[model samples]
Target: MQYSISQDQNGTHLDWQHKNVSPEMIDWFWSNMEKGFLLWHPEEHEPLQWVIPPKHGNLIGAVHIAPQTWSDGKRQNLYIRFEDFNSVPDAIKQYIEYDHCIIVAGLGFGEGSLHVKEPLGYRIHQWQSDVQNSNSVGVIGKSNAFGWKKSENHEQGMIWAKHAGTEISNWGLFLPQLFDLYKVVKNTKYNPFMDLSVKRIDGVLQYKTAN
Candidate 1:
């Protein structure tokens, strides 16, 4: 696992790699959550439920609610709404090529996303507070503060950073096994293990078979 902290802001960047874990596997985990989340972090994460299930397996506009326990020992319900890389602001987009990134919001703290890049790793970016002077980025409550304010709740941000690392790191332990099983499953209605390409049309993320 690899991670970095933003010295000037309240954000965390994490990356983890697991053998044979493809982007499709990541999609499958989100498309059929609950079980995977529980497996990843049984102690801090509870079963996740869809507030609004995806349409035809597309994750954009899909909403999921997960009960999570923070490092502060506070339990909070996160309502995450999935979006596409297009939703990422230009300020951040200019830094990286996010063609296959899965963006999300409604964390009540900030915004975040999952990006799978070359050399094969899962990149996680959690912006726990406002960015580019725009409140539109995060569309949730601020009760937790998400450690955005450097002076006030920076410690809370640190806790979140460490917590996120632990969760993603745990994924490396089991995802490879799950992927192996997925490869052998036959007679399935859909192949969730196949690599899919992401395209943004008119501001919405659309998935299609990769060439």
Candidate 2:
């Protein structure tokens, strides 16, 4: 998809033309793209700030999130922390104090085109409780086996995918290289796991329905 941006008296504007694209989809695309551009060029955009120290030891990654206004005049923000779920530090939890947050994690895959089925877990209990405290909010997981409560309030919700394709691909491609780089930089042992726990659920659904 191609997109164009223009600025006028009425703030900045974005225009895009693509077949079979809905207005809502276009708005979502534009919003994410704008946020991504701001993230990629942090020097140019000062909206996103690093609230915690980045991991520089065996793992080389950083955490960054940006707050922006939604079209409905409501404030919303996304949090991104590029580190192992198990290795997240406590200091960074303060940055994710938003009323609504979505925690997306990729469940690793195992053999036979099945989800790895690891125990579904969250790093911060306070946030989980906060989400629960808000009666009008709840969490949703791709796999219902996860311990997320269902609620009537659909307006505010959190979703987790059993196997997020983009995240699996990203970790699959980046982790090996990162491990190798870490070994060389820190003079440590390198253990690479080529198993990417991901499968396309759409195809599975179609096959099941057809069969």
Candidate 3:
């Protein structure tokens, strides 16, 4: 929820512990994440589904998976590209390369490496930052299915909302938007969905958030 991103003298860092990493991998991740922070067993809610060590967080540059991605419909934790952290200055790059992708007519996108959802059927939303920026996803969807739009009144700042006055509202708002716009079509195949705004809850980051 409270995702951290920063840079340092040695380089830029974005660290967070994961219950899905291994001792060896954690060591490798931390060694290079000069400016990254990782809290093992993090008390946050992230859509990432995997079993990593509660060790150091990963750098945007140096983590690697042998297979890259999966073809079968299974959740993947390898969205963020570890290789990009190799930047000499450690600054997070704005773009990266993508090699694998699914082929389709109306909906087709390359495996954005770090995007939350697979890009097989959804229409690509935008050009990726680079071949190594597996840290986040660009907008991805079809033209009619759930789509994203900027809120006219929106500005720049951390935001929060209360559904029954609980923090869960932050993610609840995100889940539906993803499903209705992308995942829903992932399984149900529909159109005309919705969009969501980036918001924050007590410093925690949520869908569409940039800072």
lDDT of each: 0.49, 0.26, 0.22
Against the true structure, what is each candidate's TM-score?
0.62, 0.24, 0.18
For every candidate in turn, the CA RMSD to the true structure comes to: 11.7, 18.8, 19.9
Error of 3 at 176 (Å): 38
Q: Least accurate stretch of 10 residues (summed lDDT) in model 1? A: 139-148
lDDT per residue as tens, model 2, 92-151: 223233222222222222222123233222222111112323343222111111222222
Task: Estimate the TM-score for candidate 2.
Answer: 0.24
User: What is candidate 3's TM-score against the reference?
Assistant: 0.18
> Whole-model lDDT, candidate 3?
0.22
| lDDT digits (tens) for residues 1-211 of candidate 1 | 3434443352444433333344445555555565477877777988887776765445666677778897789886756666555554443333333334455554443133222211111123321212322433221101111221123245655676666667766655676567566566553333333223455577555556632
Per-residue error for 120 in candidate 2, Å, reads 15
**Candidate 1 at residue 169, lDDT?**
62
